[model samples]
Target: MKHEFHWSQYLDTNHQKFLSDFKEFLSIPSISTLPEHKEDIRRAAHWLSNKLSTCGLENVEILETDGHPVVYADWVHANNAPTVLLYGHYDVQPVDPIDTWDTPPFEPALKNGYIYARGANDMKGNVLLLIHACESYLETTGKLPVNVKFLIEGEEELMSPSLPKWLEENRGRLTCDFIANADAGQTDKRFPTIVTAVKGALGVTIDVITGPSDLHSGLAGGIVHNALHIMSELISSFHDKDTKISITGFYDDVLEPTKEERELCAQVPFNHDENIKRMFGVRDLIHEDNYTPAEVTWFRPNLAVHGLWGGFQGSGFKTIIPCEAHAKLSIRLVANQDPSDIFDKLERHIHEHIPTGVKVTVSEFGVGAKAYTLSESHPALRAADEALKSEMKAAPVHVRMGAAIPILATFKAILGVDVVTMGFGNGGNIHAPNEHQNLAMCYLGARTYARFFELLGTDGPVDH
Candidate 1:
């Protein structure tokens, strides 16, 4: 099971071309959150399918999902070798606050050795690395060392609403020994890391309507209750003075962090003051006693209000009481917590707090993902650690992520396999304005993934 190979040297010479191709891939405005970009999402899927076919992957096709389509491809010729599924998403986050960006979010720009784009850091750059790594192996050796399958989706940013059923229906087509996820990032730009745990998510929209239509404040100021006032009260009711969730049973299923897990979360390198100033652009942050910012972010559950709207805005004052108020609320869940249960309790609590003369409605936005953890002793993780050491000359760091990736737990439940979420992108500016990732990191990631493919295929402990 051998062929001529020099992936690292090839990367050394062809990195500029790789960056150019990646820029082309990132140019598509495949914002899944916006319905207007459906064509763009389809274009991105076709583009990826073409790239995979060019790489000589068999069965390359665009499989339809209820929402945006999924791109699937594979090479399964390796006899008795471990099969690996490479997962990523082509759709990107909506570029809201577009005025804050120095350049257009969809337009790729190279500056300071980093590529500025919407999906550059959060995912698309890493996706390109996976594709090119597999392509490199096939191009150089004319065959892959293992059976590889790609299951890139188009709706991860939307909590992957259509993927669970798709996975269940196509389980036989996508069976694999383990999954390699390119969505998570490294501890920092300098060291490799593997994400062992991730927080789950529950999203809901709160709507309040107190009147039939907007009424003049002069006529309704004292007679009618303002919907915005009621909405503010409802939002405030979600938290107590101590800032913990006030809903009953919200914390019932939460698993408190163990001492060893807390220690691992602390091992991630971050300067508190610098991160506060540079990464978050805030003067200070709040946390309970005995927990660092990283611990609070990666280990604890928290609620946030993402969007609030219900009034008039036309560069001047409109003397009318808005009849309706709305807010977008989300909660991050820790291990053992169920998003459905939390939503049920939250909805009940909101109804309990509704004041007289006002009607409230709460509805979940997405299906929600569950929190998950992988043991350090997993052979797939050990193989990834060795790959990082071999390529970057440094041991990998194990850390938990604060983001919600619903598919991780689904993969474990459905396929009975754990995903190795090794990091490669820059940590700063994900899901924010001026999002960017280091091109050098992408190159290193390509080399590391190439080596990882070989490790998973030959003399690797993943088969056990």
Candidate 2:
């Protein structure tokens, strides 16, 4: 119970600088989804590279991919201890509906024990915590407890479109025992959560052309096929009344969850059905027949129409049959589901349903990834478990996220190491407006990171 946290002194001395740097880091609108923010993305990468250098990390380089850059840094002086590839993203999701935010999304605001900013939780804060945790050890003890290599990329918000090829191209330099992904988080402030399982994702867009141009509904309503209706029908065909994906072979590769695994999912603190209702302000939660809320979230696949657009805007009453319609869809996959296979099946289904007068086209909407689950006994997972228990005063909850990290599969398949996620984040508005991070939780995350390194190497969860 009486351990000297050597990092505590460094943390106390540099508290003000930490806040100042965090705000500056969050201020860059590195919205990866927007072309206009490319410069900001590069700015974020450079800023992070410099910050890593300042943290005593060696060989800091802004490694360029075909898309955005990946900032790499390392401190490999732990002498045969385990090496952890710490993964993070410098990019934040685009703050859509910007008018809904109380303050500007990029301008970080510290109020009510939270830091309100675009990347506050979904991960600029997570990246900074890793740097500070490493710095605390380097500054106080002149070395990290374990070797660490940072792989902070600039395109996670786009589901890491460039990471697969980029990771394969640089696998030799990134050889490690495991990955420490700062892209995930705890279920609540009361306890820590280890994301042992994460769902895969496949994104696609539907484009329908039913006519040459817009025509009056009175003239074209019966004669012409409506593009909007065509697009809607195309998406609607992916599901039946139960909302289960009805695509051919959609469930073919899905790995079923074990009885024990489902039980553990049921034990998690965050209730999926309840939170879905509360978070989205929806009155009813949809179900997939023979599954609990937790089971559906952790084990099953889902299809969702995330974005849709067609004719008729200003002040309504524009009675016209639009010539074109478009929609964006997101499909979440569980174990053993291949993104490519799912993508192929989805494309085939769309074409099969195309009406005689209409032409339908579909393209990959964004990035794709296969589902991933870490081994229960991975050393890095154990270290994270111990460190979280030491900090949170409770055993960490093991949970599966229905969302995709997109790059986790690439890490395992290409780099041959399972990524052990040790992020301090959550599901509350990660890609929505008014995004915020609990400053206290961020500090706790930093402390836990230091201890995890200690447990992974020569230190005893603290310094003398």
Candidate 3:
């Protein structure tokens, strides 16, 4: 039986309505980190709930948490049909330095074939695309091909503090045959793609206190130990001369990519020169030997010094050794690496290198482990490939992300199923000023998701 939802036909008919509704959503300024915007976040969650209910989803409600609400909806009628848990975030990063944007971030200007807004790509736009897909299915066929559920959260940007607990408490309600996360980037400006693996992360802050108070460098330069210099030495110890991460046992649990995985990654087009030119850099990327840029980003562990601060930054130098200095460091871990074990090892490494004269303290932030990956031969990958081929007239590429999505790992542990991460959007100053998402991809994503439902319904459960 050929189950077809002619989504394009309805999309053509309702393009204007879609754009208008999306603009309204983008205007909400649902920044999760700010306390003043708490009501705005709730308003966004309710808006999503209303949209889901209007699309004929049953049991729609805003599930409240300690921080923000989670909008959940489902339509699970078909006993044999596969259930898909679609995941996305309604929260967006705070728009600081608002002066840098040409148009107001909340206003959502459409220009140059893209939509420019705070959450355009990072990821309210993608969330709306999924909703639009469900609407099209309901309008065209009066029913969906498979069971669908949406788990949209309002605190994804604020470290997702509430999600893990929410999932643990509502495990029975969130169960599904598979999950689809629409929060990643595409292969390029052209081809659609699926992310098979995402890296884990651990963040730690190191502080060095040298003296009781800031002392004049000219008066006590030789007497006091400089906290800034001590902190710098500790930071330098984490990297070798070749720029490889030197933290002990960092790679002990890393699972190497198979020979076939390497071949597939190599086949993906990567012009190193083009990347360098885009970044305005004069040198190539530094990494361990025998690995491509894609491999370094997806298959390897990395340590990065995210921030450093000490003292004296006015118009001129304050001649002081400073009382204290501090730095924030983050590590991106690959598959099989435990975040707690990594954090312990890193703290030990820092302690070994601490200068004798300076007192040091270490603090650990949120720790998240890497997610398990399905093989390239998995049925979900095949269905995604077929869907992209049919909808976009192109073969989809398989890739991995260097960042961690703790929710993905949570779903794996609690629900006992691997997820399919297929979405559209390109990485371009995403967390920085002037963030944008391609209009074509936004529209194409909705069409692709509609096609995915049709394909999944026909193909049945994805064989491991």
lDDT of 2 by residue, 1-464 (tens): 22245886677667677788899999999999889999999999889989999878999999989899999999998886888889999998989899999889988988887888899889988899999999998887788878899999988878888888888899889988878898887767676888888889988988888877899999888888888888888878889998789999999988777889877877776766786577667898887898886688889999999988998977958999999999988899888888889999999888899988788888996667889988777656777888999988888877788888888988888988788877887435688898888877877888888888888895322110
- Which should have the higher TM-score, number 2 or number 3? 2
> What TM-score does candidate 2 reach?
0.95
Q: List lDDT for all candidates, in order.
A: 0.85, 0.85, 0.80
Candidate 1 achieves a global lDDT of 0.85
Task: Check candidate 2 and list the clashing pairs.
Answer: 185-425
Q: Which candidate is the best by lDDT?
A: 1
How well is each residue in 338-407 modelled by candidate 3, as lDDT tens digits?
A: 8889888898898888867768999976545555565666676777788888878877787777777767
For residues 184-298, could you state the per-residue lDDT of candidate 1 as single tens digits? Answer: 8764545578888888999999999997899999988978888888888889998887677788988787777889877776666663545545667787777655577777787
- Better by TM-score, candidate 3 or 1: 1
Model 2, position 453: C-alpha lDDT score: 86
How far out, in Å, is residue 373 in model 1? 1.0
Best by TM-score: 1
| Sort by TM-score, top down from the best | 1, 2, 3
